[model samples]
Target: MATLLHIDSSVFPAAGSASRAVAETFRKAWEEQHPEGTVIYRDLATDPVPHLTADAHTAGFADPSAHTPEQAAVFAERLKLIEELEAADAVLIGAPMYNFTIPSTLKAWLDNVILVGRTAGDSPSVKGTPVTVVASRGGSYAPGTPREGYEYVQNYLSAVLGDMLGLEADFIVPELTMAPQVPAMAELVPLFESSRERAHQDATVKAKTLAERLAA
Candidate 1:
């Protein structure tokens, strides 16, 4: 059976988090289609991965035989994370834009998973994996928006997960998420709601399609 790696990195609670909700829409459909398959769930909000440090960076590049005890520990953790990604037939990541970028927790996970000469670099280990990203932004960042160039989450993910890791990624973005909550964006409430509904629908369709494709 196929395995799916599901990662959630919303600091907000699942109940109100747009990214989490959209990812769940995909996950629910995926589970329905693959009842017997496995799901590896990582809730980064509650179990946050450590941000990349000098030690972690050294551990990733060090030879296993030469790693010190502390470096070995860091290496082992990164190995586990990479192995999970390697083993998965598909991946789902909930990436909520925080401060115009991705959550620190999600960035941490990316740091751990990206291993030079392994997942990336010349001799990349993993490739052709399908990844579905639920990217929820608090404000509008479309091409015509003033903050168009300010959005970094999706572009960063595409570069790392898609170009570097060789994963085929599809993004489901729900923009203007703060419209209802922020008084300054009150006029965009209707647009926000419409975008959210479209995101959920797209998630459902993509999930089912991916499940079927994996099954085939």
Candidate 2:
């Protein structure tokens, strides 16, 4: 069975909010499809992984052949994140857009995952891994519509990550058509449940097929 990494960058928990609700639906669907698979959850908001420091940044940008003791720790953490991604056949990122961008919490998580030589640009460890990015937004941003200009957030994920991975990228974005004016308590619950359910199921099927190939 493949090991899955579930990254939840929102501040909310499963019990009381829309972002968490969406994340759950996404995770559950994958779990359902890959019952034999394993999942490791990392919630950034509640228990944040530290952001990059000059030390951390230099460590990542540094060459792998030689690392100092302190630098190695930072490098090791990055590799751990990469290992988690590489070990899994797929990845699920639950990130809600904030101000036409992803959350800083999620950004912090990305800062860890996107290592210079490991995941992208020149020295990648794994190629062709499937990734599903679920983005929740308060407003609408569909391609070619009037609101299309607002859709740069998803585009950024695609361009940056796709260039890095050289693989297909699937995005599941749910916009709150009635946000701000309508309380999330009423309008967001269904959307969250449906998206999560679908994502979980999708991953399960993919994992099984990949597992079979690997077993061969």
Candidate 3:
């Protein structure tokens, strides 16, 4: 059976988080299409991945057999995270914008998965892995918007996961997620609702289509 790696990094609970909601919609569609498929769910907010550090970095580059006790320990964690990615047929990530970028936990996960000689480098290991990102932004950042170029979540992920690691990534972005809650964004409430609804609709379509494609 196929396996899907579902990752959620929203600090807010599922009910209040737009990214997580979008991801849930996709999950439902995915489950409907693949009843027997396996899902590996990771909620980074409650169980955050440790941020990369000097030791982790050192261990990632060093030969596994030559690693010191501490380095070996760190490398073991990296191996577990990479194994999850390598084993999955598809990936879905809930990435809400936090201060114009992705959550630290998600970034930490990325750091661990970008295995130098294995997943990266000249003759990379993993390639064409399909990834869907539920990107929820608090404010608008589409083309022509004042903050048009300020969005980094999609760009960063695409660069690292797609361009660098050769993963095939697509996104369903829900903009102005803070419109209903933030007083200053009250004027954009309608836009927020529309964007959110559109995201869910798109998620359904994408999820079903992806399932068909993967099954074939």
TM-score of each: 0.97, 0.77, 0.97
* Tens digits of lDDT, candidate 3, 93-146: 999999999999999999988877888877556688899999999999888999
Cα lDDT of model 2 by residue, 1-216, tens digit: 766677887666765444566556666655666688798888888878777666667888777667788888777776776677778766767777777888787776667777666677786655676666777676667676567887766888887667776545667665662353477545665764565456455544544554455445
Write the residue-wise lDDT of candidate 1 on 1-216 in tens digits: 989999999988878899999999899999999999999999999998777778779987778899898888878888899999999999999999999899888989999999989999876677889999999999988888899999898899999998899899999999999998999999999999999999999999999999999888
TM-score of candidate 3 on Cα atoms, chains taken together: 0.97
Show model 1 residue runs off by greater than 4 Å.
none
State the TM-score for model 1.
0.97
- Pairs that collide, model 3: none
Ranking by TM-score: 3, 1, 2
Q: Which candidate would rank higher by TM-score, 2 or 3?
A: 3
Q: How do the candidates rank by lDDT, highest first?
A: 1, 3, 2
Where is the poorest 10-residue window by lDDT in model 1? 120-129
Residue 203 of candidate 2: its Cα lDDT? 47
> Candidate 1, residue 102: CA error in Å?
0.3
Clashing pairs in 1: none
